[model samples]
Target chain A: MSSGYVPGLEGIVASQTAISMVDGENGRLVYQGYVIADLAEQMSFEEVAFLLWEGRLPNRSELDALSLELANHRTLTQAANITLDALPTDTDPMDVLRSVVSVQGVEHRLGKPSVPLAIHATASFPTILARFHRRQSGLDPIQPRADLGHAANYLYMMNGKESSPEVVRALNTYLVLLADHGMNASTFTARVIASTESDLISSLVGAIGALKGPAHGGAPAAVIEQLELIGTADNAERWMRDARKRKVKFMGFGHRVYRVYDPRAKILKEMCRRMNPKFYELATKVEEVALQILHEEHPERPQSTNVEFYSAGVLQAIGLPKGYFTPTFASARVAGWSAHVLEQAAHNRIIRPQSEYIGPEPRKPIPLAERV
Target chain B: MAEFSPGLEGVVAAETAVSEVDGANGRLIYRGGYLIEDLVPVVSFEEAAYLLWHGELPNESQLDALREQMATARTLNKSARGTLMAMDAATEPMDVLRTVVSAQGASKSLTKPSLDEAIALTAVFPTIVGAARRRGQGKAIVEPRADLGHAANLLWMMHGEEPAPEKVHLVDTYLVLLADHGLNASTFAARVVASTGSDLTSCVVGAIAALKGPAHGGATLAARNMLDKIGSAEDAEKWLREAHARHERFSGFGHRVYRTYDPRAKILREMAKTAAPDLHRTAARTEEVALAILHEAHPERPNATNVDFWASVVLTGAGIPKELFTTVFATSRVSGWTAHVLESLADLRIIRPASRWVGPEPGKKPLQLTKR
Candidate 1:
């Protein structure tokens, strides 16, 4: 047997399904057998969520029911509220989400025999987002309105006011774009935790913890910081030159899976254009400058704008606070985190990776008094 | 069968006044003497930080010296400042922290030299974070004031002016509450990295990265979000009912280690009493309602509130924005991260774990795909 199986296929089923696919070689992403572009443009976040969860677009009644369910669960429990109020204001939103999700496990349903826990995750996700916003803003959380769709209601609850159509569309697109990626670290973590037969909250918490790592969920915010440094288009080249000199990895340019282009970037680019043409123009210029420098530095590596680069511009245009960019990403990716956790549970197996041993050989233990 | 443990098992031997973790029970005790709650209420953030780093409460002389050292370290290197300024403003603060931290090792010497080296290293972190924050805000980084105390200087750098005594005191309390918490995942991770004989900066960098995980340091953001959703105490019970029905996890009300209570929660509860009295009352009432519901609904788990729950309330009452919750956690926990790293370095053993072989056995012949 090979020492390392690059493509881990120990128990992967051969059956084809309409969930998602990662084309690493070509750097493409597709959801439910549809290209990300198609879905981001034609569908809402709720529609994509239903597609991922139910394997197809929801029918009108199913969609409405799902939306109402999501909306109804938007507010947090009193205990959760107290907890939310207790956190340091400066805590990272990702960490906050992680803790919040773990607490959910306390009340999670564990002994069900029929429907898997992922369904419960789907039902609970909107509430998680709602509660997160409420605690951070120091505002009393808004109860979800049953009449509203999930995407629309999330914005309403977030701002404690009605959302504009444009804002809702932008947020919906962001959610769709981030709903899933390939088996990234957090997804792997979720699968690992799920394999232990631990509860879904534990799995989700594991995923959240994984996502909180700087190498993973910290990208969107990094992209924003990169753009700010470039300042005007005039300084873009100089900034790129200096960044390369310092060997700093431009936050939004590279991807582990997408070698050529992040398809989500394309969709977000479109969203930015729709949101504010001027800001979109500046964003495009920023991307052009970054791509140009990347091409010059390493032509072999595909370095194009990823979702984070476009996400920065899109979020800024929509009036999201600069600090909240990553938090917003968390809000959207919770669905993906939930989905991966459920998938891991369905075919539970512990995820324990081997390491190349490079250490001193085992020796006789010394007495503790002599160790110092 | 060789007994295998997936996680590392060993000893870390650095002397620290920071936090202690009881992994078996999931309790985190901060400092040599005080419980996390006691410190949070009675101590200023600066005093807590001093206690964690020095292994005792700072007397008047020690406090003055430490404050001066921290203030002096607040100044950012030109290169580091430029780098921070260059980052995309929309970048996640955590990501910015990571990048800056990774770069900081080269920019400054954070190694353990004499007593001076350790003090210098400890002092530089607030400067790093403060400078990064300023650069992100499109403001020039402030030089630390030698005249002020640590907490006061940090506030000065952050807000570009000296803060009121009350504001400084509030920030100091926050620092104390967050300074250390036993051997949590991030702290353990830091120890693991340090065990490899890596430098202090690398170990701290790893710890920060680990702590960024939602399950560990991210709960504050989740708590904030939950608070945002409920809007007012009047809607708390209804929100709880729906959240329960949906099976969504709530933030801050449960913990992995503490079955009865999280010690930090009590500290924060008290802080909230003085800082935001109205919010504190509401939060306390909310906790009562949540506990009642959980007792009846989830008899098996019977989860209770933890530190994040009350911390969120205290911070929100202090007028901190929700998005910054995790950032605040990062600031306070650096002392713990540093202590663990130093301990790991002192012990000087690589942390390697064994895994149960679940993949194809080494001697197994490869099966042909066509045959399958």
Candidate 2:
């Protein structure tokens, strides 16, 4: 039987996936049967990506080979470089990422999505963002270093020098946490595109477009912006209460899936406390006030800070400009997007869902000349 | 806890007033109550686009305003031009379209999707399509004429000359017919992106990426290629027999929604007689043979020719190269894509669906790399 319209497709199960699961009730994120908490601090982004793609942790040799492959594909295609140079300096980095990634993955043929291709697409995200960021800053682009890991190489390419171990570790954890979150709007966009047997780049470019939304990957920067508006910890309650009265949403506060606290946010919150003491201090106060207000209004519903809330502080601590927050999230999530694309392609079907027509009953039309 | 629907086939994911595919009765309905067959004779592509966006057909002054708005937005910005020139002339047209559109739409910050933005996005497609084609042939880019109508201008930019009236009518009709087909993969991709509250350009870009798939917009080209391989009407039966023997599925002969002949296909089938008489003759013969073979294999199935079959012949008549069939489809569907995005804004929600996990049980511990 055909189910009735499910607005936003809130609880509709679309596909059978082995990649990742969002256990909302338990506040757990599982990637390939392993809990996210176990992997977040320990596994590298490359290792998590490998696990997502291969459904198992890679041994030393396999990890090395995958790293080499990713490092080798780090350089942008010639067309991608030209396309990158073509974008205006003031353009949003997310748009730059979307466009450059499209150009970078343009192929002469239509090939089945494979791990090698996924590696090639995943490797280019950082280089695209970093190169564009540098070009905007009036600096020459820094080439990617093969010897460095994904997180370290991204910082090296963005800045002219390497980042400290602490910052690199934070970025790696951010990437690992954001890698795949099971059937998210952007990941669903990727799967829906891939469900049609589209190319991996097409699926990814589509996902990037989806992620640019304020409700999705676009929120991290908005969080920073909201926090900036709040200014200081002492002003937090007053500003938030006023903003709430004006019907302004507190950025990064509510999530659709999590009935409890998001596990990723809990980890990023701790990191923010350690690395960005000032932002952490202000953010903590704001969070407390916001949650108190939210709880006052909704009493029965769970109102906890989401990943984007603490992610703002963490990314800020890592020295990213506010504009790069969403794109940085994209850089990490490309691994997940690509992994999901591979999974969707492995057991492919065209994801053509129905729509309940709310238009008028069909009738004859007026001739163009006869109309007023 | 709902049953997992593979491909979301019968799940009604949206409530849309944009258009409706009443596949049961073989009817297609556009907004404002006009049937597809009824609307085709009265509206130009711009008018069809206006109807989709505003839910009503424009009058004389309104249509003029739309035409003026579209003409003003036809020229690509400097960044878009640079991006267009950046691609290899020989790159796939859809790839070029995807990248160039993203570059064109790249902005300094996120903006909510708007009707004005939709019109601007719809107007630029022909420019990118024409530019890609001209570059592929090493021809100087032809500037779009503000005085010409949308279809006429597209022909002018692509051919560098005034198009015959009949040819423009043919192309315009094709555009009108293919403008929207209720929640199809590409349009669904657009809505999913829009549901995240993404910008209009991101939604359109994502739609274009999904349209690049062979299973979706690429079907027109495949249908045309199949006919070309068949060579003539005489070889139709032989080709069908051999293809069937080899277990090859006929291109453009089957669809997911329609139980009878597609209404759009019926109209295009009749138009194909005069548009490209010779190709139409071969296509007609091929459809007959293909249907016969398909029926022999599955008598229970209600097999019919889909829109792509006749679209190929009509497009060939309109002088679009087979390589660009999908891009041409994008040019038409951008209006519907943008319309869906705009409609989605009234009640925006993230289209995040649930996934049934098929992997091993969660909470598994990972082995250390050296130990593994």
Candidate 3:
């Protein structure tokens, strides 16, 4: 007998993962045994990426090797460059990232998912977004500096100059916090593709597509848009009340997995307070009003503020355009996507789940010309 | 925590009317309650696609409108063209497809998936596949003719000549047979992406990436390669015996869903006799020997031939090169992928399944980097 259909597979355990765990009940995210709260501010994005790919923290030499490898692969391939230019100057940055990454990883033959391929993919995401951003602004693309760290190079490539230390650290912290989480939609998409034995780039490309959805990584940019519409902290309650009356969704207010406040949101909220007081002022007011309204509407639901809520402010403070929010999320999550691909490859199984057919019984068809 | 389903094997993730694989009874049913066998003789690939998308077989005028719509949408947009030209001729066709399709669908803003977009995406697969083929052969790319039907246009673009009527019939039948099949891995990938409220192009692109895997769409090419190695009917037994002794799994002999002969495989096997007589003879004999050897080894299993086995011969007869088999498979399955995505929109919910954490305990503190 088949199991009954579970809509959205909500709470279904699909895999056993050692790479990361989202402890939703406890509001904790753990990567390879270390709590996210402990690692968020201290670790470089490169170290978190390594920890995701390999199931342990890399030693100093190993970290240096990964950093160097990632830096070396920061430039786009010739094909990727042409493909990047092929898109219109006004195309969405996420679309540009998905398309160029597909071209950058094109191969003559199928290659198994490997750590080197993971590094290659993780390195290219920022470059693709930065190049497209520059092109959109009618500026020449900047070359990536190998001497800079992963987060620093991405900033350098986008602005054509090195960012201050505080800004680089904030971007690096954002990347580290978002590098991996257990069985999210985009990660699930990546693992699903990899379950079919597809290569890492294919998996990552598919993940990027899934992340572009409004329900997932796409929410962060919308959060920024909503705050801009709210205008000032003084008008937050009135605007939000009217928007709710019109059945408009409060972006970044809810999540399905986290029963409590998202741990990443907690960290990013503090970052916003320190780095972007202007955005933080309005965003905090919006968050407070949105939460109060939601609670009044559904008191049964637990308090929820997802990672995307404060992520908008942190990314804005780091000087990224709002359009680049989802693609930048892809840049961080590619490390986790590739790690999941390798794990799925190691424990190979074709993930062809059953579907309950609700169609009619089979019947004969009429001839084309004889139909009434 | 729920029990872990390694591959979600028996999990019912969705309820769909798009198509069904009743493996228990060996029946294949498409939308509108039409058996695949019943629909094949009376309809073209365009009609089958229309049925899948609109949930009914199109009437004469509706079919004509669909054909016109498809014909007009066959040409690649400028971005897609430039992206296609950017890739080397030696790149894999599937990689070309994944990239070009992404470029083709890149837009200024995210749009909801729609029927018009679905039809356009399905219509353009041949253009990308044909250009990839011509580029691989160092030949001039051929423009699609509006007068030709879907199957004929695909053949015409690939070969730079009008396709024979019989070959068109064979290809059309193949397309109809493969247009939809239950919750297949690639279709599931498409649905998973779509469930996040992503665009149709992203869903189709994700599906193409999954289909490139050897275990899914790539099985057809692998089947043809295996047959080529066996060479003739006389060598079937010896080659199979040696392979079985060496513990090599036969390329196209097993499937996860079917307990009996695949209905589509039965249809393709019959068509292969008329399409490629000599190869058909060799395939028939090889099938007999492979089945016996498999039965001897695993007497309890239902080791019947899959659709890929006979599809390889029929496609070969239709003059499709082995290298493009997977891409050709994507061409047929895009309709199904888009159909599934559209169906999922009525009750869209993010498919974020949970994962069991099997890593280290959560409270481990990290030592300073220099101490390591």
- In the order shown, the chain A TM-scores of the predictions are 0.88, 0.99, 0.99
> For model 2, which pairs clash?
none
Best by lDDT: 3
Candidate 3, residue A180: the lDDT equals 93
lDDT of 2 by residue, B326-359 (tens): 9889999999999888998899989999999999
Docking class of 1: incorrect
Q: Give candidate 3 misplaced runs (Cα > 4 Å).
A: none
Alpha carbon deviation, residue B266, candidate 1 (Å): 42
What tens digits encode model 3's per-residue C-alpha lDDT throughout A1-372? 578889999999998999999988899899999999999999999988998999888899999999999989999999999999989999988889889999999999999999999999999988999999999999999999989999999999999999999999999999999999999988988998998888899999999999999999999999988998999999999999999999999999888888998999999999999999999999888889999999999999986888999999999999999999898888899999999999999998988899999988778877767665
Error of 3 at B313 (Å): 0.7
> Order of candidates by lDDT, top first?
3, 2, 1
Q: Which residue runs does candidate 1 get wrong by more than 4 Å?
A: A1-18, A108-140, B1-372
Best by TM-score: 3
DockQ of each: 0.02, 0.83, 0.86
- Model 1 lDDT per residue over B179-254, tens place: 7765555555455444433345445544554555455676777776776776667777888778878997777776
- Using alpha carbons, what is the TM-score of model 1? 0.51
Query: How much is the lDDT of residue A50 in candidate 3?
Result: 90
